[model samples]
Target chain A: MEANIAVSSEKKPTWGGGGVRPFGASYGKMMMWFFIVSDALTFSGFLAAYGLTRFKFIDSWPIADEVFTHIPFIHGEFPMYYVAFMTFILIFSSVTMVLAVDAGHKMNKKKVTWYLFATIIGGLIFVGSQAWEWKTFIKGSYGAVKTTDGKILQFVNESGKQIALSDFVVGDRGDDKVTQTRKNGLWFESGESVGQYSVAQVISSYNANPSIQIRSEKIDLDTKQKIILSREKGAAELAKAKLVVEGANLEVNEYGNTIFADFFFFITGFHGFHVFSGIVINIIIFFNVILGTYERRGHYEMVEKVGLYWHFVDLVWVFVFTFFYLV
Target chain B: MAHAHDNSNVKRIWMVFGLLSVVTIVEVALGIVKPDFLHLNGIGTSWLNWIFIILTLVKAYYITWTFMHMEGEKTWFRRAVVWTAVFLIIYLVTLLLIEGGYLFETLAPLVRW
Candidate 1:
């Protein structure tokens, strides 16, 4: 019976090896599906690890809504709406990608080109939007004061609005004065990278004015966070300060927390990397399509394969949207 | 050169896409508003979380079955792929929770510090 089955399979034209030929799909397409599944699993593992860490630090975890509130070309804080637009872009890209595949099936070159171009533009816009998001994240909003005990105490106005250190950091320093290097004071400087301005500088500048009082990194350094005093006293005490806002656990971030920043960089960076690769692949395929390579061959299976990949990107974004934005 | 999709099927695909987008908007609204009843603060084990998970699963199901055309495949083939993912996800989540709970308890002191 096994020999009979083997003989029967041998009668069919197997494009590639493996007796596990899927119905109505070439070996490449089958492999692509398998590859997509494995990739999906890998992404799931990373996201699950993210979930685990977030759950562990549930109380201290940064608020997603607050952090990702900014919109492109808009000044005010609008939570989730911008990301919603990004989601629409990706979903629309997926639609265009599928439409291209559909056009490919009918062998309509013009329609395929139009749809593919739309998809590519959509992807580019998404990448650009992501870059803007990263810029906003890196710049940070408000700074906090880190205490000797490694605790962070943030400053807020009477209305509980986060006051950016820059709001009070008044100085006329050159670009060289404000840089993010590895070391300015530490001689060891093995990394030998540029360093960001010391938090001390921000505090000193803030203390320069009389209206603002020195708030210790420790909320209970003396008694309350609000210190009442004149300019001379605030500046005098701020000069002797040893600690500053290295990082914090509030909505108003300073260079953001390393973990949050790292995750943001890593996850979005990885996704962006995928988009880059997809664009390269798309470009190659675009050239091929223009050359009428598949058209001459009388099959647009290549287009279909790439469409599957493009849609996979879209599908991943849907989940990323949920996990990173909504959740 | 092949004409696999008829005009009727094309229209159907667009209809499905519209439906999917509508469902997504609904999910987003639910997520954004985070209704009082859906608020998991005092609830047991977070019904909102469960709702979100279920909705996510539904979306995944639609995407896979309809968009990916997995529903058109052979019964055993579909089962093999879907069931493998389902079983593995279940196993992974279980192991993760168990190990995570253990680690959380063990590292509680260090964490507090």
Candidate 2:
């Protein structure tokens, strides 16, 4: 490669060749920039397609706030505060990543290692938090009905207050609520597991209730949002009508439209995957630092490159947070 | 070209990050509150989105210009990459919008998937 470049240089003048180093850095940095641009386009395509779907389902689209409700330790329900916290963690990690690069500039191995370690831990924590969120989401707190036409209808009381499925779920099935099963029932004696709640149970419960009336895509008279029954049904019906249905008119979703779930999983999942890779990369770089790779090389460009990647993750999050949580 | 930035330049990066954080917090608050004026008719296509897009662009600009050091690069070098990206993005958005409009038309019956 060096001989080729030397021969090519000896042959003729190529464009703007002003003492440019053949393979020192300029090409790598340019390549990274191109990669970032193309990657950004890929993400934009995903997000834009999401917007297209969202716009199509304007009326039936899931509310971002209501869908992603989980308060770290508080448990029961809180709006998007946990996600906000996660965003902060990621942004903070980006800060530490930058600091690592800064330490690299000073050839401060100890400081660089410390910051890189913190960044890795931060990335891991963010991934863990996202996993926890997915757990809560998949194992939905409250239950809703899956319509025959493939839409989810959540349960709200006569007072129009959202209620948890736990409030209505009956005596222990001991592991009956399962989605995927073995080919043969007797193939494996599956251990008793309190499986994730089902949308079907809510429908049957509502059907059995004498006072309970079904709420369709149409809105209730008073509250405007869909409810299990009319306000006139009152508390008596609310108590006896132990079923609630929720969700929207889309493919299949744990909560609402499958598109919402799809976008949620795809965007966050991709971001989480990036974080995981970032940690792995940081670990490799961390070991390199310990072994004095940069000290011997007399340059910390590797740290800077990794820092760019880390900040790029945070940059993606900034958009995800806006689209998913805000807009 | 070989010059190295000092502590003050690094401090400037921190300042930019601080500004970005502040803007993000404001975005969160707006999202949560969703003021009556913002939602007076409905939250669809309001001034808030404008604020968000503008602020987001500002943050992106700072991240690229400051942290990525695009501002320090040769004019032609910066333009070669940045302008291509900008134009390509605009072109893609246009295509998506047109395609989306067509899809919307067909989706009323075929939209179940």
DockQ of each: 0.25, 0.34
Winning candidate number (DockQ): 2
True contacts kept of each: 0.09, 0.17
Tens digit per residue, CA lDDT, model 1, A1-327: 456454455555544644455675667777777777777777777677676665554444555665677887778777777787887787777777777877888888888888888888888999999888887776655665544434344444444455666666665432454434545564453453333445556565665554555433221212212333345554554455444443322332343233665666777777887787787788788888888998998977788888778777777777777777666
lDDT scores in order: 0.65, 0.68
* Per-model TM-score (chain A alone): 0.74, 0.77
Tens-place lDDT per residue, model 2, A57-143, is 644566677777877677565676788788888877877887787788888899999999999999999999999888777656565
All candidates' TM-scores?
A: 0.77, 0.80
For residues B1-113, what per-residue lDDT tens digits would candidate 1 score against the true structure? 22555576567568767866876787677766777555444342345556656666776676666656677667876776677766776777667656656665665447431
| Docking category of candidate 2 | acceptable
Off by over 4 Å in 1: A1-20, A148-152, A168-257, B1-5, B40-45, B106-113
